[model samples]
Target chain A: MAEQSITSKPQSLKSSYWKAISAIVWKDLVAELRSRESISAMLVFSLLVILIFNFALELDIGTRRTVTAGVLWSTFAFAGTLGLNRSMAVEKERDCLDGLLLSPVDRSAIYFGKAISNLTFMLIMEVIVLPIYSVLYNINLFNPGLLLVILLGSIGYTAVGTLLASMAVQTRTRDLMLPILLFPVVLPILIAAVKASSGFLSGANINDIFPWLRLLIAYDVIFIALAFMVFDYVVEE
Target chain B: MKTKPRTLIALDILALILLGVSSYLALVFAPTEATMGQVQRIFYFHVATAWVGMLGFIAAGISGIIFLVTRNLKWDRVEVASVEISLVFFFITIVLGSIWARPIWNTWWTWDPRLTTATITELIYIAYFMLRQGIEDPDRRARFGAIYTLIGSVSVPITFMSIRLYRTIHPVVIGTQSAEAQGGFNMTSDMRFAFFFALISFTIIFVDLFWNRIRLGALADKVELLKLKVMQ
Candidate 1:
């Protein structure tokens, strides 16, 4: 951004998309790794949510398995919002977003870049929390099926969360607006994820849980496509 | 701007007449029910309000896509109008529904898919306004509004479906597994007439209100423009 002077050069579509996307994702990853701000905050917040639910709920051995899915999904959802709000706020504060917008790369590269980084942070939090939940509850969440559901669910959550978070950060309300705006939109993802997780945990038949999976995939695809197509409008000067 | 359009006048009166006739039919034309009796009358307005709410939701979603493509503030006005109208209609529907549920289901509320989804949709609508209000830039506000509306539209249907799935699988049908778990009723010819009439009338009423709201929005825009000019 040092050379804020307008460049008349046009960035080619194909190369800019992948190049800028990977660069943005890598930047966010490296930045997060060093500062440990967004990830650590999200991770600690998720653990606290789990801890609160542990005391708030009376999950006896019988009811424990049934509820672990709900507890995990809600914790992830709240933590996802935390990560999204911080990630976007950081960009706004540093003028990094302005720098990116001024670049020759396609605007969508920025969207994908931010979304993947946000998703990575959420998944990392989940990776840390799931085992803790499993150990505390004596529930086995190691099933590959459950893991897949978590991935699909986080994808849907982050895709929409990233878009909404971008808007929320620009608003005067900032972080508070993120959850209020994100929760209702990301509800389908949360519901589908929780149901699918429960199905997997309960050893429900694969045929039965297929609809939830389809829902997760459908939501992830629709929102991701929408965010890509519309990110330009959202970020336009 | 000096004189009101005759079509607007006619539409306003027509909406009034339709509402009167629809209420008459709902209250007087239809016979009393076998099981529920007079309380069933709420169904007419309840169903109509819910229908209008859905209409507004769809209109908002479409206007959002249009605004995003055209970057036109006009479509953004339409989006806000539809959302606000739908919010009012949904509020009525929820209240009337709670009233209807009291005697029939012996409860004020149930976590039915429709009920829960309606509440969530209303919350989204409120959040939409909050999001818009927090931004000072008009263009950016409209842009963000459209994006959030689209996101809300895409997710609500899936929310309904997921809730429906959970209900069917878990079956909160209490002890009995009867179809009447949520108060099923067979509509007679007269009740059917009233129900359908309510739906048709509400659609017209929604359009009428939508048109008026847009006009109000235009006036508001004018005021904003004048205020800006004065400030400059």
Candidate 2:
């Protein structure tokens, strides 16, 4: 390996921090693509939830529009939780978390990196489920506004989810604790996303959707900032 | 530590007297509400306890932050004290709210915003203690407890907003508007006197109980350290 000269500039350190985050996110995505364990479990679990909701709610086309956003978000929330708990659990179980912590990178880099990977899993699940749901219910869920809301919601959800999961995974009751810890905190994002998504899908007035969109954005900003600032405490040894 | 300080003793006496007077004022002094009659008297204690609960929550969050910043066991004691008192007061608040709700809303429970938020806030604190229980290392437990309290402090308000928004957007088709919806009468002159007195009395009681709880925490810590030293 070439001997890279050590740099003392703060800006370089900052850039490298982002680079490290991207690297971790990339690693997880590549690993997940090769193994297909986390997403597969999440997808199957989500499908089952939707199936149960199918029988439970009996969503015909008429009723589906009203409930589509709720069912989809509920599925994402549960499945996202599953993915998050397992993702961090995998890191802990394999002793990868300690190794990553020992790396010569900022801790927030690892926080963001894991958050992005977890967000990717949730977003991918959302993307795959939407099409199948649309096909089943004869409704197209490919609206741009709805997609934006999903992205914002997922970002906010995964931001807190990743932080809380890190803490939960350290506990003796690791996996079981994440949902109990995450749900109450991340509720605003879920509410706004479902409300906005439902509005966009049902062709409701833009005015009805604007408040939810704003709420989603606000939650994303607040929680992502909060998670990033406090993540150091969460993952500190 | 200093022997159970004289001020706390004085305050304890004051608290008991205030509690007695406040109860008398509420039960006998305040005029009977027109609509729900006597059960409405629970509002005096209910609001008093709720105020104490909110104060405890704020105190817990502040102590949690102080503990994290200073890494002192004193702040941890404060945190635990606030949580314990808040748990007890909030429990009273919920029960009194329920009792008051029954005759007013004609239901034992309604998923009203304040009621739901109170329950959720209670659970958050409960989970805070559970998180603390799972960790054996005092330092680590303090650290994690502080972090969780910070998280709860921010999230509770957002939770309240979301639930309130949900209710406004889609209200219950069947149930009457919550207890608040039952057109609660304005406080009469005597009722206001009783209410304010109850609030002040509970504030004193909270301080007394919190001081005792902090002493208990310090004693527990001493015992834990002693046990560790003996074992070693």
Candidate 3:
């Protein structure tokens, strides 16, 4: 009876830890669903970025073959920043962050919760953008490899982005702070993602694309661990 | 306020003398290269300043971690001092590299991995200062600053590796030269002497500047405290 009680204690703690994470995620999702603020902004902003790139790059057939990946990744990067800034700023503006912090849960649970929600928002935007991009450019971007790269890239981007966004919202220039702090750090993800996407779209050798996939996965793992370790420092009052 | 320490004063003078001697050794003592000629003289100072920049980069990253662990304001001062010194030295290295490249590579710039990584590192530090500027609380500013530096340091090495997927044309001086590397040259015994001397001298200079900067940071902290007291 004593052994069973001791073993069961850790099991319950583990479940409750996950419960805290999902609770925060559920709160964000429900709030976002009702408001539609972050998603609408990210979607419309990304579409505009694509339109601007069309005129700017003169994406004719030949250029499109080479630059489609670049254009798409750049659009996502800009729109990701917009969504990240809004997500954190909404918390700060209404004092939701303080209440969240006051709850009896580990701080890293907050980090994962925010990161997962940010990743979801970014994935939704990518889903909408990919089809529109394919239809307009007359290029099929539906390869399994391409989707894998997008998912991995968004995970790395949002993992770091969510951490930085939390810091940015507390600053005086909250809106301007996110991109300045984020772009240089996330350059690796953009480079690897663009390379892998282009390779898949161009029907290049699988061997050539595997290295970039490795880099994207490695980046996602390193940054998620780093952010989890240091998040407590960022949020401590 | 405390007076400047006697040791720092003496070390500053020694640094000045070493700088002059290192310049003399590099410009007059080292032989002219057959391929690059006099423009190759920039290599000595360029390499030395880049070494100093790298030293500060490591120092800032380590100090940032220590500051986060210790939660001590003194480590914050050390982090900021090293970052400032590194920022200036890296800019000098970039300009000097450009001057050498124009005559050698026939262009002002190319998107080589090292060159791009250096520029990106510079931008990251600039953004660090901008982040610090936006926060009013000193403790919060230091915390964010340390976190950002930690992030920048980790990301920079990965950035270099990712960019290395592309071919690099920058010359490999220390290691065996790749077949495709441009402007590669063999250093004579005298040139090695000058290069080593320059590296040592620049390291001393980096230490001197770092100490002075930390003292300045300490002074600034004192002023902030006094002002707060007056307000109360």
Instruction: Score every model by TM-score.
Output: 0.93, 0.92, 0.97
Q: Please, what is the whole-model Cα lDDT of each candidate in the order they appear? A: 0.87, 0.84, 0.93
Task: Estimate, for each residue in B148-193, the C-alpha lDDT of model 2 and write its tens digit.
Answer: 8888888888777776765432122134544334535667778888
By summed lDDT, the worst window of 10 consecutive residues in model 3 chain A runs over A1-10
Indicate the DockQ of the complex predicted as candidate 3.
0.88
Off by over 4 Å in 3: A1-11
Model 3 lDDT per residue over B59-160, tens place: 999999999999999999999999999999999999999999999999989999989999998999999999999999989999999999999999999999
Q: Model 1: per-residue lDDT, tens digit, A68-154?
A: 899898899888888999999999987888998998777888899899999898888889888888888887889999999999999
Give the best candidate by DockQ. 3
Angstrom error of the Cα, residue A214, model 3: value is 0.9
* lDDT value, residue A226 of candidate 2: 80
Misplaced by over 4 Å in model 1 are: A1-16, B168-181
- Which number leads on TM-score? 3
> Model 3: per-residue lDDT, tens digit, A155-183?
99999999999999889998899999999
